[model samples]
Target: MAPGGNRGWLLRLVIAFSFAQGAVSMARPAVSYRALALGADERAIGVIAGVYALLPLFAAVPLGRRTDHGRCAPLLPVGVVLISGGCAMSGIANSLWGMAVWSGVMGLGHLCFVIGAQSLVARQSAPHEQDRNFGHFTIGASLGQLVGPIAAGALIGGRDMAGTSAFALLVAGAGGAVALTSLWHIESRTTSKSREEQGERVPVRRILRARGVPAGIFISLAVLSATDILTAYLPVVGEHRGIAPSVIGLLLSLRAAASIACRLVLTPLLRLLGRTLLLTVTCLLAALLCAGIAL
Candidate 1:
């Protein structure tokens, strides 16, 4: 079947992704709070947050290779299991190091889910529909981001910061589990078979040398680093500024809502400014915003 022929699977995929992303979003702030309550300072908190990305960094390529040669559907459940386990474990962990370890697990799980889902989209979508499909796919992430913080804010606040944050992590785990219900037959069997039959994988160096590839990678890395830092450190800022957890959550949700709005208007922006100018303008604006935040 052509990628755009039937979008029902895409809708289902979006729903599943929403829950998974939501769980991660909720857990991020809760982790920070829990760490703070456990006597971790800013530097220690930064290390824990960094661990959330570090452990997954090396695993991404291997997972992608595996998905290229095997089934994508299996990875989704595995990812969910890891995410759920990690969140729950993080909640119960007593020390900063233990929290870091579980945070790494959660990051690894997120990486797995993303790799599998992106591969699934590529394998199943027609070349012509790739852009549109990916846009739709990311809407799931935006939806999760929008809702997760609000939920976390509602649940996580009070004198017993540790206790409330732990409860929030547990709830996040439960939310991650909800994605399991939407994973029935998500991948196309025929496409999976065809991908397995393909020849040896492309080399990383060659891929990097391809036109626009390196630039895209760098751009993605920059945006992701900025976003991750903001997500992980925003709570710390709130704590220092005497902001309530509920208010912090709302602020985070507002950031997410803005992201969603940007995605929604992406096509129009592209039409108006074209890709190059749009990219330049957005990057410049983002850099300025970051600087303003720093100030």
Candidate 2:
């Protein structure tokens, strides 16, 4: 396919990613709150939340290895299946262990979808176009991040905690299914074979040891940890501050919008500050923001 021919597919991929990410974002806090409703203490809630990240940490490299050598599209559908089941199951699970298990499933599904989607983007775009294409791709993630929590906050509370929690999970399941619409024509068979031939199966250690890799990983981890903490803890902060749900939603959306704007102007930002300086500045600012939130 011509470069231009792939644009439509990329657009569809972005749309699907947005919805899938939105669902996961929505479900996460709902899961936490629901677990609390089921008599879980703060420690149990933390453990359940941590489980989402823990299992995926073990699975990501292997999944990446598989995608490097095989088809990316297969992971998309498989991820959807896992995400949908995990979200729905977590809602109905009576025990904390069951919720933790399903949360891990959801996290694994997220990792699979992201790895496949990113690999697809890398495979389809020319080297010169990679920066712009990736920027566009991540806009989908920002949109989901912007919208998901608001939807969750709106839907997830009521006089009946169990009932509201179940509803949130159902919505998440429906959101996961939306990804299926984009599966058609997402990956061409020819491209898959070519990717398998061209991509190297780098060991996790080597990938980590490569120049700039460690720094990039650390930066990504810090940024993500900041975002995760904000999402998971903000509502609790809001409660303490007596901020209404609507206000909290607006605040989160504002933060996401700022991130999207930053991404939109990333090229200019890089031109002004260079990569290392830009990363440093952003990380520093994010750290301050996180600290402010804590206070």
Candidate that would win on TM-score:
1
Worst 10 residues of 1 by lDDT: 187-196
Q: Rate the local accuracy (lDDT) of all candidates.
A: 0.87, 0.79
After superposing candidate 1, which stretches have Cα over 4 Å from the reference? 1-5, 188-190, 193-197
Model 2 clash count equals: 0
Candidate 2 local lDDT, 1-295, one digit each (tens): 6543448878888998898888887787778767767887767877887888988899877788777775677888888778888898998898999999999999888888899888888777877888778888998889887887788778866567667877888788788889889776677632644553665656678877899998888888888777776766666666557765556666777788898888768889999999999888888988887898788
Error of 1 at 123 (Å): 1.7
TM-score of 2: 0.91
Which residue pairs collide in model 1, if any? none
Report RMSD for candidate 2: 2.1
How does candidate 1 score on lDDT?
0.87
Model 2 lowest lDDT segment of ten: 188-197
